[model samples]
Target chain A: MNSAYPHWKKGPGPMNSISIAFASGKGGTGKTSLAANFAKFLSHEKNVLLSDLDVEEPNVSIFFPENEKPGSSYNSKITIPEVDLNKCTYCGKCAQKCNFNAIAVYQDKISIFQELCKGCGRCSNICEAGAINLIESEVGKVNEYSSESLEITEGILNTGNIHTKSLITDVKKYRHRDINIYDCPPGTTCPMVESVLDADFTVLVTEPTPFGLHDLSLAVEVMEKLNKKFGVIINKSGDNDHIIEDYCKKGNYDILEKIPFDRTIAEKCGRGEFYYDDENYRIKMNNIYNHITGKIK
Target chain B: MKKIAFASGKGGAGKTSLSMSFHKYAKDNSLFADCDVDAADAFLLLEKEIQHKKPFYSGLKYKIDENKCIQCGKCADSCNFNAIKKTDKYYIEEFSCEGCSLCEDICKYNAIESRSNCCGELFISDTVFNTKMIYARLIPGEDNSGKLVHEVKKIAHEQVLSAEKEFLVIDCPPGIGCPLMAAISGINLLVIIIECSQSGFKDAVRLINLSKKMKIPYITVINKSGLNPDIDNNIEKYLADNEIFSAGKIPFDKEFVYLLNRKKLIIDSDILSGNLKNIFSQIKNRIEMEK
Candidate 1:
């Protein structure tokens, strides 16, 4: 039965299988819960990898308790420039070349905001004098937890650290095998863009309310700008909230699925579990997986 | 003046609605700022027209001068972000570049130049409730959200001085990331609004840990209460274990959402207003004590 579903593989080519990212401009519409449950649901038939790119607050790993016993973790480091005062020429070339404003030069001293430096190597490369040197600093960690068929790879940003985008990119270094589901961070910021930009298909999880409608529009605009194929999945649909449907009809967007608003489901969410214990949603997920893989072909 | 910000690491944890009620009930000369620039909704609920707007320039970004490029491919090789690309001609992918200037550093031919990019816009407005509010919006696919958050706060402070407000209530974006940090930096108090759900507790803990690290005086007010008795008890136990003082709690209500959709504050219109008003004042007293 697991093999009954077709793998989202490209024919004799170098396509990195199928990667689907779940994103929403607004937070707390159950993006993590949906991603977590759907990842397990798809793993029943597919080699699914759930990567939590919401480094600031990764909740997907909360659902995978079996894989909780001390997984192999690695640190993420960024090589920021450390200036050598002895070899310094106050040429101000390095200061002018830094786009992040991480460097500023005065008549007597040069000031650098270390956290602002992205270690892009420009400061070192542009230094006319041999003053700038790069030093690696551990900023975040990427951990891999596997149990049976499912694997959860989460990017955990160290507090007071501001390298979310780069660490999110680093977390993707673990992507291998069939289908990869990236649980992206909320908002349409650069970090979310980085995670959802190159996917085969994207699932924009939204609820049917005014806030949902507003943020969904922003997410839609981003997906359109990236030229990526995407559809909407209303996570907490209720009878009164038709704002999402009204806009989707006007924009002619494809709605993948609508998980009706259920109190039991939400309570289950609180417990890091899905509400429906039966195969009701498994069949729905199968349809989604089939449609996306079919689109790839 | 005492400044307070409401931040929950998880979204939809009742930041904006709670801020509105707190501002109304706090009854001080309050300046409300929405640092949730990623998805500002306090304005939506305020039902106010934009009083003022200005483009926010984060910093300088570089672009290739297709004319000066020798297609040496050297800048692309030196680039760590893989921003420099080659198709018809070598061009810089705007979003990919972290504005590191390494490309310009490596370009010996002087083909790359830098200029200010409009990363976002800051706005000044007043709520129908007669409270002054300042908010900002980050343009889609733009970088430097943390910088924009700072700009919004700066405007908020300026507004506070000019308007002679005594209290500053900031509505922060979800997450313990840079934006929320910028929103609450050097504030008088940190009033965290925690929802009593399991995910809510998990998300709130991340932010609580952040506040503890920043060494800010803080309190917690649980929202969406009476959802499930078992979950609620667990939340209370966790709050007690952490010794994070609970200010008050608001029972879950559906009418609140319907009213919010219409841009109305529940504190003024709903039957739950009495309970919410009580919670707001209790939270207000805690702020006063902290102040």
Candidate 2:
């Protein structure tokens, strides 16, 4: 056992369950890699649950084997209104009341687009003619996996589906009560915001480039707007560390750790091989974990 | 006009860099739209000067007047999103409130009022390449990105038609979600940028599936290739097995990142421009073949 890891036990208090989310406004900034590695590192000493909330493009499962997948899986559904045209007075009132434009009432027929519906149930409630019925429609599925000491939950959205935000909410229901880490979707929009909303702290992973800095600033704006406690981690650090370091310094944001731009690590990650087992990466991951727990304290 | 877009399921897969290069190579013949409104970096590389800006108004938000509210908790019970909460007083959480107006309809006290919300702003700008560019920035924490993307596409379509441009190149947001659907709808061609990695290839396949489902013709270009020979070969095998058409591959080069640090496009650089130009020409040929 690594002596560097602090022993964590579940207890009743304000610090009963600590959850942290890793987010990046820019994709491919190593959010998944860093989150997965951190989960593995923390699991060495404490039970950890790593959840992939990037329903649209959930990749956390890629790092784990499928045969070891747990039996807990269920179809995620949303209540979408379907028109029962038999009793229909083709009043356009329900159509007019729907803000998402998911329904359209025409002269002879009405069309209900399931993808546009946010499952608000307003249409069914407002349908005075009793033509609209709220039905459970499958939007995606949630699966849980257990490997070694780490537990994994994945929210996978079906292609052509638009209810990414709702599916993420369903996935969060599986969060472990002791320690949870969420791998968030890229961008500062609703999906990313929803993933990090309940987290006690957030780790913003970014590269050391102009594009990274620009998007990092936007993510910082989101964290600040949400009044969330967060720290920064530079993934592909090189001579360009100052690009992010300077920004973090100016904003008074804490820099947790910097993973250098090593080709070997990239290639290994490309093959679904994680480097947290490496002595150097283990140390870095431990440092980030300690830093977060320090903040919570 | 033909609308061609550069998109990938994974972020930082070199979508913006390649789309910008294609924009430069297309010269004045094409207009550009950066549909990745969440983090629009194309504007930074375009050396753009804003010509016009307009507010993007979308959806409605309800606010409760505490003085009029009797604390009956009907609105809170009726809200589907759990946006209404009682903490000293009942209030609507703007971020969680989807503006479905259910509370307003259920309120008997007239305490709840609805108003249109300004989610973001769109910009029409002139780029250094002497072509028009369309982009927008969605207000953080707002979920109206698909609507914002639609607005960008509408302005771009009008601009392309009015200017008589032959092609419209759009840089789509990552993921196969609503915003991406809005960007690729009715587009003539989708240039899928596939990064040479396990996660990257998996996400790209999803994007390709979405394109096929939408009946939009697409061609793949492998970026960051040669990072791992095994992974690269596997990607090639997948493309071949699926009979997917690929424009070409771009080797992993640090020069591209170096140039981007300087806020310069690879097309303007001497070392990497040759390979990129060749790949982009193949993309152009694919677009022409569609016509």
TM-score of chain A of each: 0.90, 0.93
Best by TM-score: 2
CAPRI quality band, candidate 2: medium
In Å, residue B204's CA in model 2 sits off its true spot by 0.6
- What are the per-residue Cα lDDT tens digits for candidate 2 across B1-291? 999999999998999999998999997789999999888889998956999999999988888987899999998887777789888889888777778998888889999998898989999999988899999999877779999999999999999999999999999999999999999999989999999998999999999999999999999999999989888999999999999989889888888888989899988999988888889899999899896
Per-residue error for A106 in candidate 1, Å, reads 5.9
Query: After best superposition, candidate 1 residue A74: deviation in angstroms?
Result: 0.5
Query: For each candidate, what is the lDDT?
Result: 0.81, 0.89
lDDT (Cα, tens digit) per residue for candidate 1, span A82-200: 88999998888888877778899998799989777777877888787889998777778888887567778898988877888888877776555588889999999888898886678
What DockQ does every candidate get? Answer: 0.53, 0.59
Candidate 1's residue-wise lDDT over B87-206, tens digit each?
988888776788766676668899999997888889998777777889988987778888898888888888899888788899999888778888888887888878767778877888
> What lDDT score is found at residue A32 in candidate 2?
92
Which lDDT tens digits does candidate 2 get at residues A1-297? 000102233335234789999999999899998888888788878878899999999999778855275847877777888888898788889899999888989998999888888888888878888988878888888888877888888999999999898888778765464789999999999899989998999999999999999999999999999999999999989998898999999999999999998888888777777799989888998899889999988
Q: What are the runs in model 2 whose C-alpha is more than 4 Å off? A: A1-15, A66-69
Native contacts kept, each candidate: 0.65, 0.78
